[model samples]
Every structure is written in C-alpha cells, then in structure tokens.
Target: MTDQDDLLPIGLEDALPARAAAITRAMRAVLDTMDAHGYDRVRPPLIEFERSLAGRMQGVATRRMVRFTDPESLRTLALRGDMTVQVGRIAATGLAEAPRPLRLCYAGEVALLRADQLDPARQRLQMGAELIGSDAVSAASEAVLLAIASLEAAGLSDISVDFTLPDLVDVLADEALPLAADQRDAVRRELDTKDAGGLAAAGGQAYLPLLYATGPFAEAAAKLKALDAGGELASRIEGLEAIADRIGGRARITLDPTERHGFEYQSWFGFTIYAAGARNAIGRGGTYTIRGSEEAATGFSLYAEPLLEASGNAREAARDTLFLPLGHDTAIADRLRAIGWRTIAAIGESDDPRALGCSHRLEGSEALPV
Candidate 1:
C-alpha cells in the first residue's frame, strides 16, 4: 500500500486490542443493565437520507454532517452524526404504533465533521437509552436514574450528575425582560461563562442571580427560589426539584440552571454525567420533543472512550485473558468459560503465553500461572 493509503484522516483512530476490549466490555455491561430495566435494544443504520436524519431539530447543523450523494438513488446520504436523532426518527415512523412510553436502547458509532473541545475525537462510540411517548416527570426521572445505574454497571465510581434547565433563560427573558434575539444570545453567552458584569450590561439584570445559583442541588434550588421569578420559571425550578427528590441518595446530584450549550433541542430539563477521574463528561441527555411531533423523550448517550479511561478497574479486569494449550479438552474450555474466564486455545506450538497477551495458561488438568 502507498504511504497515503496507510495514513488515517485527522480526528479518526483505530482502537487497538486493549482499548477495544475495554470499550466492548463497558458497552455490553451498559446494554445489559438497560435490558434489565426493560429497554428493548435496537440497531439503527449508520447512514441515512440527509433530510430524514436532520429532522426538524435546529441544533443539528448541516455542516457538521459528512454528506455525499448516493449513486444508485441519486439522492443525498449522510453518515449519522447523532444516534439520538436516528432513535427519534425510528419512534416517529417505524415504531409509531408500538405503545405508550416505549423504552428503547441503542449503542453505535457516530462520525462527526468536528469534535467539541472536551472530546477531541470526531469518531465516537455512543451507547444510550431513549424513552418515547411520555413527557411525564416519571419518565424523565427514570431516564436519569437508569443512566446513573448503567455508568455504575460499567465500573465507574463516584458518579455525579449536573442538572440544567435549558429553557430557563428563554422563559425568564420572555416573561421578565424581553429582549431582541441578539441581546438574548449575548446574555446566554455571558451566563455560560459566568460573567455577571456582561450579563447585567446586556439588559439581563433580572436574570443575573442565576450566575450564583449553581452548586449542590438544595443550595442552588434555594438560591433560585430567592430570585423571585414566578410563572413558568418557577414551574421549571419545581420540576427540577422534583427530579432531584426522586433521585435522592442514588447518585451525587448538582444543579446548573444557566447551562445552554450542547442541549439545543432539549425542552425542559438537561443533564450531564461526570465520573471521579475523567477529564470530560461521561454522558449527557435531557427531555426533548421528536421533530414534527409533540411526543416528549428523555435519554442519554455515554461516551465509551472517556468512560473506559475513567474506569481503571474495568481495564484491569479486561486484561485477564487465559491461554489454553493446543488441543486442550473442549469440555474443560467450556467449564472455564462458565466460571467467567476468557480462554483462547493455542493454535500452534509456542513457548510463551505472554507473547500472545494471555495472563494465564492451561497445563494438563489444571490452569497454571503464566
């Protein structure tokens, strides 16, 4: 092969053996947990017609998609940049008549034209669950709780969740301090950066208190209530409080009422999950409306790469592969597997099992340390 053919494009990567095994194990654990919770698994295509994938969500930018023309159909096709959108499409068309509060889960790879600052890889492994046909608080609460459980099942510890009211700014601005679109954008940018002065200068003084209302759930809720904002703003805060109450003593929970980025489509509540050692968020999701319909859905997608990084225990456990001698008994191999050992039979003569990345080796009737 030529040198050019051997090089991979920027933002793309090949997951080597160790990392690949860890990712597979993590994803399987998460999917199994979701299945236990009654979330039916579904596999969506990696590519679809451009319009169908984009749907009506304003957050799904066309430039971020890797698009090309299909030769056979003479139509534009694009690699899916977000699996949530595909799941939404599935609920709307294929599973439209399934049932109320349909629970679905999916895990797949998505390619993006650009990556965010926190996650630099454009190609990502996204594993998540979605609940459709219900906008009730119970649905949102269940999604959040299930996400925490899945991350724990993947062997992550000290997991914490930060809740965001994506529509809080708009609700406050519309009711208390009406501003033009540009002014609202400026205020949002200021709030995102925690620039109190910029927010006040941009005619968002009424919403300035939100800058300080970010911390532990109870403390932040108290500060928010003190802002004296009533109507929908109050209702949104109450909803967040309700979610917190439901998730009590399950996982560490915090509140960030002013966060607006990365949740362009979420309607009421948005959230992000963090682990003890990871440098970036492990997952994020919230309540959103499937485009062209009023059905409310809530779910999250966990980034496998980062989760695997934070889960040191998972990596160590994945490395415990056992090497079996050539022509070893098949029944013994089956029994070893039943006891939670990953055994690989030797194909040819070899002196060292370590050369083949096996931690243990089988000798006669008993397995010996390598």
Candidate 2:
C-alpha cells in the first residue's frame, strides 16, 4: 500500500497507545471519582441498532453517528453518537427491573458528525456519568461534583464550568414578541454570532434590555430572576447560585441564557467546562426529564482530546517495566492479567522454561527485549 493510503479516514485518527493510555488514565481518574460516589460502571457496545440510536438523537450529532447493517440479519447498526442516550436505553429496557435513580458511569469513544468549520469529524473519547430516575436537585448537584472532581482528579485544575438552563429560551419564546418561531431561531443565531444589531432587529426593543443586561454571573442571575423567570428557569438559577455558594464561589460559574442552541434534548440544567487557554469548551453535560418518565436524569461527557491536551502538563511520568516467565506463559499472563495491564507479547520466540512471553512496559519505560 502507498503512504497516502496509510492515512486515516476523515475525522478519525488512530491514537498512539501512549496517548490512548494517557486518556485511559484520565478517564479512570474521573470514573474512580464517580465510582466512589456510588456510580456503577457499565460498558455498552460501540454499535447498536440504528433505530435505537437515530430515534434517541437529532441534528448534526445524529447524522454523525456511523451506521451500517448486520451482515447476517440485516439489522441496521450505528456507532453511538453519545453515551447518555445509550445509558437511557439501558435504564428503560436493560435495567428496568434493577432500581430507580440508577447511577451509571462510562468511558468510551463516541462518533460525532463532522462540521465544515472548527469541529470536524471526531471520535470523542468521553467519560461521563448519568443519574437516571432521580428528581432531586442533589442528584444534579452530585453530577457537577463528579464532573469537577473528574477534572481535578485528572490534574486539570484551571477549568471553568458555565452552568445554564434551556428554559430561558422558552421564556423568551413565550414573551409577547412579534417574532415568529423562525425569527426567534434567527435571533438566537444572531445572539450566538454576538451581532447586537441583528438581535435588536429580530427581537426589537424588548430584547435590547436583556442584551444590555448581560454581565458577570451575579448581574446576569439577578436580571434573569427579575425577568420573573419562574418554573424551571427560575429554579435552575437558584440551583446554580446554591451550587456556586457551596463550591465557595471560586468555581467560575456563569449563567448563560444563550447556552441553549443545538442542545434540544437537554431540558433543564446545562453546563460546559472550559480550561484556561483552550479556545473551545472541553466538557459539557446537562439534565433533562424525558417524557413517559416521571423522574429527571442528568449527566455530562468529558472530551478526551481536549482534556488530554489541557491535562498533559499536570500528569505524572512513571518509569516502565517488563515481566515474563518461562513455559507456563498462559499461567503468568493470567496472573499479570489480574494486575490490570494491556499486555502484549515480548520480542523473539523462546521455548525455555524461563523464556516464555509476558511483559509490562510502563508508559515511557525502555522497550522490552524480544
């Protein structure tokens, strides 16, 4: 094959084992924090029935999910676009009998559709937890803690969480503005573009006050409350304030009514995590109570590429080591297997009693002899 042919497919690349290991360590740290909080770990397959995946997501994310058909049965299959939906399915069907308020955590790659600008096709190595069947604000609160602790546990300290809710838009939509549904979406698009003039044109005078009112969280929260935003919107602002207070007000929390774009599925609280120098947000999670279910569920996904990029400087370097024993290769391999290593065969062929293959190479350690 030619060198050109060796290149990876669009929006996908093979991560070196070392890089993948770094991601795994980061994910493990986050998962450990979740596990400590009574969140059980579960592994779902990379692929599922297309109907299952398609019906669960929409927009660019749904389109980005890789799809295929089973060869034997011709059942449509798709690589998951997000882990939360898969967990929701598990809660609805797989674990329906287990219990309510199920706490589940997972770390894996989610395939998302590519955009021409900024975000291209990417396999998001994500670690996240879901609080299913829970209606308490505490469950939502714990999700934030787990997410923050995940970053802290992975050595990412200089991170910010911008917490907001979707209902703010609903509030705007309910106002007696003359703009139509499409116009509202356009105003939203204009706000996203930060075009003040465009926002004024679409929303007219009523929207200008809201635009000018934007500022640091304290000011914004006060304005949101003053708007008489009650129900979900009001409650979310209060929740965020309480969370900020609990976290000592040093967590860099923000209340953004403009955060609702592209996240139609997130019904209640929404948040995005940003590292100090990163141009884009690194992690995002939110809560929503879906229909046919009485309880609210919430969760977040930690993006692996950006997380590793921001976290490289904080991670510790450890020396490597290799261990292999003689002819009882399988026995030694099993013993080491219990120790948790992504074991690979050592170099050279040897049949000696003490020459069987097995090796442990710490991340950056010297290469093992064949």
Candidate 3:
C-alpha cells in the first residue's frame, strides 16, 4: 500500500498561472476604488480559534469550516470561511472602543466545504468590504455604487443590480397573509426557486387566493395596497418603497416579497448583481443587523472564480522568450537580468533559433571552453 502517513494531496487549488495573474490584476483594480472611497484595508489571518468563526453565520457556513487542534495548547482551531464574521469579531473585541462606524476592506481566499454539485476544492478567492454600526440610507447607497463601479472596472458590461428589501417581504407576508411559521417558510423556499406552482401549493392558494399572484414591482405593490395592509407593516413597506424611489429606479430593480426569509441575519435591504442569464449571481450583499449585539453591518462578496470565468478581461499570457548563447557570453545574462527580461541559457550546437527571441551569439568564456 502507498505510505499511509503520506499527506493527502492538496485538493483545494493551484490557480493556474494565467488565472492567478488575471485575478490579481482584477482585484487590484477593484480594491483601488474601495481605497479611494475611504475604506481602509484590513488583513486578517487565515486561521483563528474555532470560537472566532462561531459568531452570527448560519450553521451551514459554520460546519463547512475546516478545523484542527492547536499543537501547543490543544485548543480547537479553524480556517475562517468568511471574512465578514471575522471582521465582526475584530470589531467586537479589537475595536470595541475604537469608533461608532467602521469601514474595512479585505481580499483573501476563504475555505468553504464544497457544497453539493461544486468542485471538490474548498478554497475560494473573495474580495469584499464591511460597514459596521451604520444604518444610514447613504451607507446603503454607497454600497450599491461601489458594486457597480467595481464590476464595471473589471470590464463586465450590461450588468444589472437587483435590489430587494428583505423587510418588505416580512411586512407584506405578515400583513397580507397570516402564515404559520412552517407554511411561511415553505412558501418562501418555493418563491426563492421562482416556482409559481410550488409556491401556490405551499401557501395553500385555494384558501388564500392572493398567494399565486406575481409580477413586476408595480403590480406587486398594487396588490399589497389593495389588500389594505395596515399599521406598522404597511408603513414599513411604504418606507422601503421610498428608499427604492430615492435610488432613482436606474438600477435594474426587482422586489421579491420573499427576500427576508433565508438569511436570518439579514436586517434590511439586500441586493445582488446578475450578469444576464448567468447561472450564478455575479455578486451578492446586503445590510444586516446581528441578532444579539444589534450591530448593523452591510457588505457583499464577489465570487472570483465565476466572475473571472465570465469576465473577458483576464490578462493575456506572457510572451515566451528563449535565450540562446552561441558561444559564451556571461554579459548577456547580466544585461537581461538588469532590464527585467525572461531568459534561458542555450547550450551547445543543437539550439533552435525559431524557438527564441533575442538570442545571443556568445564568444569564448571559461564556463564553456572556447
């Protein structure tokens, strides 16, 4: 048998040269815009104590994190799967007394257990930002603008940002239909899948005739208004609409009345960008308030691998250059190194001129006998 003690081959990734170069260049452009807007960069280590990764994220995300035992103290440790949670911990512990509103940015590889139907590799390169302890509309607007600017900088065209106010869904569902917890969850799941028939069944369409109706935002809003949604829920829906109106309707906007359901921590508006007809969303983010701490946060993460695949702007392959020395010229090597050029020393008479650029015809040298 092969040595059992041998380390398992690295499964996650080795970003191919071209892909790595492209990702680096793209990230630089995106991060530059972030820096210009007053968001300072923060580099958090890849590994932290297990409890550090344990705040606010769903159980799924928590379980996927790779864990180990510390050799010195035998404390449980884990590879951080998401930066935002770590950033939150940093804010809670490190920056507790620092400031009211903090703006931070990060670009790093995150490890997530491969979800079903994903490649076996768990490593993912992500670039994202966090705005903590702020609930202003301006902060939300800035987040949207940042998303637009970054995607455009990366050369993606015809991009559309879909803005959804998760609270609007909660308000509407609570007022329009008195759904039991299980029934409400089933309806939201079906709606998330955009399956009209399934959603109808989940909401018990015949008993609640309004459940099946679906369409553009205007139509949905009209339906809600017609239902005579009253009190705080109604006011919250109007408040959300005014926020959307303030966004100038320029962004390709959509309202999924079911938005607030899945991500338990999502507190307010949630938006995601989709490149027309792409299977995966290009990016996703939203404002959320942590449950117990009541700390408000907003941010998003770009799926670098998919974004790179969809992005046509990956840097071109570096030009190949072969260095051939007819005789022996140590001087040529020195010059090439000085000018920052790629070079290879050719030996003997069998070197092919067609395969090389700027080949040298060297003369006598001690290294190669004259």
> How many clashes in each structure?
0, 5, 0
Query: CA lDDT of 263 in candidate 3?
Result: 46
What lDDT tens digits, residue by residue, belong to model 2 across residues 211-284?
A: 54345678888887776543435566777777666656436766666666545677667778887756678788
Residue 118 miss distance in model 1 (angstroms): 4.5
Sort the predicted structures by lDDT, highest score first.
Answer: 1, 2, 3
TM-score of each candidate?
0.90, 0.79, 0.75
The lDDT values for all models are: 0.85, 0.68, 0.65
Ranking by TM-score: 1, 2, 3
Q: Give candidate 3 regions above 4 Å deviation.
A: 1-11, 118-121, 172-176, 180-184, 194-228, 231-251, 260-262, 276-278, 317-370
Per residue, candidate 3 scores C-alpha lDDT tens digits across 25-55 of 7788778878887777788899988876775
Candidate 2 accuracy as lDDT: 0.68
Error of 1 at 200 (Å): 3.5
TM-score of 3: 0.75
